[model samples]
Structure formats: C-alpha cells, structure tokens
Target: MALTNSKPKIAIVYASATGHTERLTEMIVDASVSQGLQPEIFPVKEFDLKELLRYDIVVVGTYTWMNGEIPRQLHSLFEAIEQQSGDLVTGVFGTGDRCFATYCGAVDLFRDMLHAKTQLAATLKVEQMPSAEDRLRCDAFMNSVWRKYSQHVENLVAAKP
Candidate 1:
C-alpha cells in the first residue's frame, strides 16, 4: 500500500534525561508524518496509557542509566504497558553511549519485556551522539517499520475477502 494513503496511527513515547532519546523520538515522529501517518510524541512522565491503547503502533524510547536500567519514572509506565497485555502492535527504541559495554541497555530491557508479554513490531537502537549516519539509520528504520506494518494491515484486509 502507498504509505501516504495508509492512514496508520503511530505514537512515539520516550524517557530521556539529557534529551537524546527525546530527540530521536522526534525524528521518528517526523518520519512517520512524512509517510502520511498520524504521529504523536509523549514524554514518559506525560504519557497516558489509555491514549496509547488507541494507536495502531506504539514506539517506546528510553535512555539507559548508570546501571544499565531504565529511568525510575519510566519504570511505572513500562509496568502499566505490560499489565494491559492488549493486542496493540509495539516497537522499542533507545539512545545510549556506545562506549558503554551494554550499548542501548534500555532497548534491551524494552525488547525483553515486550517479547515476554506483547507483540513487538521492531526495535531500533540509536546512538547517543547522533551523526548524519545515525539520522539515516533512524529514517531507514522508520521506513522499514512503515512498510512492514502496512503489509500486515493489507494482509488482514485481504484475508477478509
């Protein structure tokens, strides 16, 4: 299907202390918009679980802390997401210093939790200090997601015939 005509609803929610993750979320939102999808951005602190359930795709972004863990504020949001166990399609992303032994630690946590509970559409690990390459990577990842998701929806529609 043509992305502009897909009318897919996408949400990019993130927890960021130094703004890197938040910036990445914005990039994803921009890409979504360019693809003709309805996109929204929410900070973990300001996110509403009920609103999240309405989206066809939920992209969760987080930053890793000193101990390779998600920020405390986002922990509760993650728990809430896990508890719902709805059929919402989900994706994960994270920004962290590549110097760390466990790069993109938060992405790992998000992936593990979602795999153990809900269906995951994709996972993107973006670098903390983004360069031109990083931006291209993020755009590519978003494009792949849009393509895969549109295909999934198309298959569902075709099966109903």
Candidate 2:
C-alpha cells in the first residue's frame, strides 16, 4: 500500500445544464489550487471513460434530472466507476433545486456508488446557483478529500519497512 512519493493525479469530472454544477466545479478547482493540488477538469461527455483508472483522485459534479435520476450523460461514467477495483479516492458533488423531491439526488446516487467503489472522501449538494455559504462547504469538501488521501499515504509509509 505504499503510494508513490510523487504527487497523486487528480481529475474533476462534471456535467452542467444551468451552470450551477459548473460553478461548483470552479469552486472545487479553486479550493484545490489553494491547497496546492492541481486537478484536471473534464466534462462528462468529453472525458474518456477508458482513462478513468489513470487518476488517483476523482471528483464528480453532476446534475439531477427527471425527479432524482442521475443525468443520462453520467450513466456510463457511473458504470465504469463501479466496475473499477476500488483504489481510486473519490468525492461527489452536485446542484439541484429544492423543489425537486430528491433535491440533489444525482449527487446522492453518485455518492452511494463511489462509496462502494472507491475511498469516498466527501459529498456535497447545492441549491440552484451556489451561494456564499456553499463556498465554505466547497473548501470543506476539498479539505476532506485531501485529508483522506494524505492519511492513507501516511499509513502506507508508516507501515513500510
């Protein structure tokens, strides 16, 4: 379990319709940069599912659709993730309106799947456009995910000869 001393690869994959999720992506990227970690951003449609395993960390930003259903665009990525061997550290976040019965159900759906498929670090959901309050939450999410990865690497090193 000894992770490489080099920096871990990080990818932020997301889907946005009304731009709320995209905004969240910006916040996450900013937070990661503030923490000195560079994360590559990918739109769900453009990201190659085949390239998923190349990253040590994956963060998904999604939008709910059709009453809590995960966006159709996300289905392939979801399945690909679930099929992985669970070494990836993942975080899930999304945006939705409160009027929906499921709120940000897309995030919840991704959360559950990632939890089972990878080392899940954090899950975040924001209403419509993000507010100032959500920025703090974004920082917390970045901290949590980084902390999870750091602790795991530390454990590996401690257990090393």
Against the true structure, what is each candidate's TM-score?
Answer: 0.83, 0.93
Residue 78 in candidate 2 has what lDDT? 93
The per-candidate count of clashes, in order, stands at 0, 0
Taking the tens digit of each residue's C-alpha lDDT, what string does model 2 give over 76-150?
999999998767888999999899899998889899889888889999988888887788899999999998888
Candidate 1 deviant stretches above 4 angstroms: 1-6, 158-161
**TM-score: model 2 vs. ground truth:** 0.93
Query: Which 10-residue window in model 2 sums to the lowest lDDT?
Result: 1-10
TM-score of 1: 0.83
Candidate lDDT scores, in order, read: 0.75, 0.89
Candidate 2 backbone collisions, by pair: none
lDDT of 2 at 73: 88
